[model samples]
Target: MIERKITYQHSFIGQQFIAKLDFTSQYHSLYCARLKSLKYRCISADESGYFSLSEIMEVKVNQSCLIAGIIVCTYADRSSIVEKYISKIGILADRKQSTFYNRRKEEDFIYLEDESGRVRLDLKQYFDWENLITGLVVAVRGVMRENSVLEVIEIFYPSADPPRPLLRKGDEFICFISGIEIGNPSLDPILLNLLSNFLQGNLGNDSAEVAKNIVRFVILGNSLYKADKENSFEQKAYSDISADIVPSISKSLEFFDTFLAELAGILPVDLIPGEMDPSNSSMPQQPLNPYLFPLASRYSALRSFPNPYECKIDGIHILCTSGQNINAIMQFIDTQDPIKILELTMKWRHLAPNAPDALGCIPMQDDDPFIVEDLPNLYVVGGMPNYQKLVTEEGVHCITIPKFTSRQQVVLVNRFTMESETLSFVSVIQGMNNC
Candidate 1:
């Protein structure tokens, strides 16, 4: 096996995501920061001169105007935090619905808000309502109606930043495996062994050659899963519950450590935490603690990064997440296409625009870390329903790697050409030759 001479760098700089948060401040700070970062870009994208940009309060009835602000969508079925909390305590019946959309779509209202004020938006004239969601920074050209509503004529999304140039000489591949779902009782242990053997160059000649080119292996979340559900009694009693649960957790960690150690021993590996992973339950989820994987932590080849991990491999910026952001966006939006949702975030220049609304995030008062300041060469979302890839016009490679447990698939992309292919492993069946 030849050595990989590629340069690798992790883009995080000292606890940006995992930090002391502003618990007192509401989510308003997040939107304020997001709007400030994106306002200039939205202004530049607006080509129509129908009206000059104005503040929400400056709009005159029956006058043409333009404004830039973060989108705010209000649904009839959407419950406030107070409502959900009170209901949980048995004060009121739970009004929470499975989806946030309203049965009578007309009752759902969209508004544009800035620091000045929020104005109701009449999006009936808007064509692409499905693409719109809460927390997006956009510019709208419309006229203020008699009822104090802005009748939107055109909506503008920020122009995507140009993809960084590839600055390396050789070709190598990065393999992304999502939803390993280890410790699931139903999981086929043979498949996990096959993947470990394949990456270690023990499967076959063809597999070994392909494995040699895989410079790195990224396990994209759900690497550990346990189906044991805590009963009501266990939930109330911490000491008794810990006795039963610790063994399960310890065993899961043992298997996960062995799995990761096998791969990291041969090549570099990145462990990204997901919603189900043992990490903070928020956007920009902090990397898994090294102490969790005792054996794998011994190897320098193993590293952990935040959920929305960013880094430069051979000078090409790559952005990845465990699919929490995408999954959150799907609940309120009309489309099931993850690629389309991924592209929407790219155009808006924000990774998880719906953070602090539909998604959980560590609140930052001054900085919105989710903003995509620079375009990456590749964007990867993990644990999707199926494997899909899209190369945007701006030269960004968007990929959704499916859960390995369900699809038995993994993704391999050429670091130079930006081309991708999906590989699946299947068990060989034996023939009844003796009979």
Candidate 2:
């Protein structure tokens, strides 16, 4: 095998999200930071200059003006921990709907708010209600009606940063594997072994050549799934329940560690925790404890990163998440297209805009880490239903990787060319059998 000649490096914003938690920080601070970060970009994107922006308080009634603020959605059924607690006090709390999207569309209200105040947005004509959601920072040009509602005429989103030119050209490849679900009893051992063998160059000659160029591998969340069914209604002693849970969790982690060690032995592997993973149930989930992977931890090629991770590989900035942010966004939007959802987040210039509202997020007082201060060259969201990829006009490679356990496939991207393709273990073996 020829020596792989390519430069690779990465730095993470993990520390920004890892600080000691102080419950005093209000969730509003996150919106404030988002507004401050992207407001100028929205203003600059409005090249027509049809209306100049003003503070919500400064807008004159019936006069055309632009205002930048965070979106807030109000509805009787919107997700709220306070309301949920209140509902739990009732007899039927558990029967409540898990999602607020089922509420009648007419009952929903939209508001644009800043430090001064919030105004209802009369967007019935200009925008699709399902496309907009709470917590997005945007600039809207419109006239403030006498009824204290803003009749919007135009909307402006933050401009995307241009992708930097590719620094080099080669066969350099990076593999993205998501939703491994290692501990699931339904997982196919055959497929698992095939994936390992293919990656380790133990397959055919062509497979060996391809695997040799793989510079790195990324495991994007759901590495471990709760395979055991919990009997929610069955009564048990607290100590007994804890005792049963510990063994199950330990067993799952053991399997994940072994699985990861195999891949890390072949190439550097970066692991991001997911919704099912045993990490904090909040946005910017911290990395899984290295101690959990005693075997894999011994390998220098193994790295555990937080959800919504960022780094630059070979000068191409990559922004990735374990699919929680995207999944959260799906609850509010009408479409299921992952690429379109990703594009919406790109336009808003914020990741997980619905954080702390529809989803759990640590209250960040200093800055909104979700804000995309700079657009990255590669944007990846893992654990989608299927693999999807699109290179935006701005040259951002937006990719959604499907769960490997289900698809029996993983996404392979040419680092230098920004070209992407899915490599399926099952199909390769079938092809080999046919030959």
Candidate 3:
């Protein structure tokens, strides 16, 4: 890691690109934005991270007051409360896996706190704590009770935008496809046939015209599939693995290169690396080494990017990740809904809070890359089996572009309105041919 002094420059009209801190403070601006958007009253936000102590003191004991703060669990902090009143108190917690065969009942003992102080919450009276998770921000109007806890009366979360209309779409569109596994000789011929037909306008209808309007095609990651020679004798020997590399060319790699060169020749192709590629399995994973991609190298339209990447295309701020964060949080949590999880992560305004918890990631020194303080116009993630999209309340496009290996689905996002349409090459080609 390199350490360099940061130079700050003053500018009035334009915004500056900067890093974000995820440990805390990333969601403060959102909390404030939410407060203002909802027209909620704040008595004192001196320490805007949570409700201030001064404000709490102003409320006479036994009187009701509005409280806002980050949620915490007192299960690990208070032994007396846990032992004496464990039956009476319910802790907001997730099922933590202590060992492969053992599941531990852990509690975050939901409390609210800021830099000033901490206040325990009793949501039993009004709100169901079942939906609450650690690190969620909330506002609750409640009466003060003994033992420094709040007796819940009302609870609130920021509003989510209504579902978008299907007709509302962006002006220009970009295509996103991932997990092509390009070089594997065992690649499905029907998959290529469908894509080639679409690209070549063999579909013979409005579908072909729609494909023509696609501004660019993004091969989101995992471009290089393992060579067919992986099972060779040299590959089996630890020291002689490089000997198997003697072939210099395998059926999969050659086919993948040819396909990339053809695609890059037609439209701008952005190649990102996945875990299978020669790159680290961490956030900001390295780009595909161009030396290995000869056919793609010949085309000037081809470009490479890190796993989690950001770029501007067609006046749109686009951010993408290879689905590391969502995969991490999904492991311990029981939820199977990817879109719901994506919405929650965006609501929290951080990319992946559970990184390095169960997910493998490259640790950042000071500023965490996952904290998304300033949102992008369109956010895309790959490495899933089905396409999903939602326009967040903040007007940001949240898209989950599915893996191309199984379903052969691709996402088309309108650049202007940020709406998305999922296209299945297999289904489209089959339908068109049968028609």
Candidate 4:
């Protein structure tokens, strides 16, 4: 067997040290140099050019450790060492191999080398190795020790660059954070401003509504973007409209009430209650009961309910039914006005066979008949044999009412009845008339 002599030196936090030794030599010189730079007190070199920390200060046995150093030289099967150490610059490289073990041993440990020199790392730390390999630079801070082959006390990745002040853009970042990488920098400004404004509540007065509208816009925009990759005119238009409207809308409870009322008038009555105000002989004061209609004998009967579909009180016409076919109803109202009808029937087609006896026909006030001046001469007829045909009439439209198949219909109807009862209670409490 032949022996080789090696010499090495290292500096840490401004202090410098040196070491000289004889070992089996092969690649031991490079390994020794790295270990020396780590400031390990005692070192031993092996035939494979691997070096171990024979002793270290302030270190205990069986304790985990971290070691880091720059690669000096990585030779072929034979070992060699770099002669000089440059402070600011360090070389990066990696290598891997499998080792055979005797039957007595269950497995062989894998060895990993980095700027910190060599250490036998567990398989679980594979990702740490990968990060190092992918050019992710890290500074590790760990415990230091001697008396064992490993020199590091602990290890961690440190930020190499100086921290910069984040640019302001509303409440969001105008620039990506340190770890976050942006593929395209062009949208940074817009994203920043939008985020900042959102954070500052400057986007709109109705924060919740504005947020909902923004989310809706984003969803619709993304859908459109997917469907039309090249052009998003519809998406742009919707965003523009929402951005403009959301800022102007008041955030008061009254605004919400009014908004809900307006939406209810246009939507199905069953889906949203109190959308329409009951007819009044004269102009009523504030706090109107938007939902003021008698319950239909049967759910299906709602279809045959008269049109213009709305009745006027002191010239203000209000819709009476919350039938499912709101779009058709609205169209009918739009096309005709001063609608008149006689003998209208409200049907409940979805009534359960076992449902309680149907409520009989109910009377309507003189002002309760559906009549919309905005629409052409129109009439809504319920309980009339020609109601369906009237709905299909030229300039007049009809929507076929759907029947509930499951027992769910009964539950829903019962729920509505209960809700009406509750509303009556509320009205009584508020000293409002329940007509």
Error of 1 at 132 (Å): 1.3
lDDT of each candidate versus the true structure? 0.79, 0.79, 0.59, 0.22
TM-score, model 3 to reference: 0.63
In angstroms, how far off is 233's CA in candidate 3? Answer: 28
- Cα TM-score per model: 0.90, 0.90, 0.63, 0.16
Cα error of candidate 1 at position 178, Å: 1.0
Report the number of clashing residue pairs per model.
0, 0, 6, 49
306-365, model 1: which lDDT tens digit per residue? Answer: 878887765677888899888878768787699988877787788888888888788888
Candidate 3: segments with Cα more than 4 A from true spot: 1-50, 53-171, 183-187, 202-207, 225-251, 428-435
Q: Which rank order by lDDT, best down to worst?
A: 1, 2, 3, 4
Query: Model 4, 1-435: lDDT tens per residue?
Result: 111111111111100101122223343343333323332211111122233332223335565433333211111321123321221134523121121112233342323345334443333422322112211112232333343344332333321111122232221111101100111122222332333343234555653232222210000000001112211211122223334333322222233233224322221122211112111111110122233222321232111112123322122212222221222222111121212211011110111101011111112111211112122112222111111223312232222211111000010101101111000112222342333
Better of 2 and 3 by lDDT: 2
Residue pairs in clash, model 1 = none
Worst 10 residues of 2 by lDDT: 230-239
Tens-digit lDDT track of model 2 for 345-433: 87778888888877678888878888887778889999899999887777788999999888888999888887899998777656767
lDDT digits (tens) for residues 37-144 of candidate 3: 332322322223344323444555687777665555333422342443443344533233321111233554567654456777777786356444444555667888
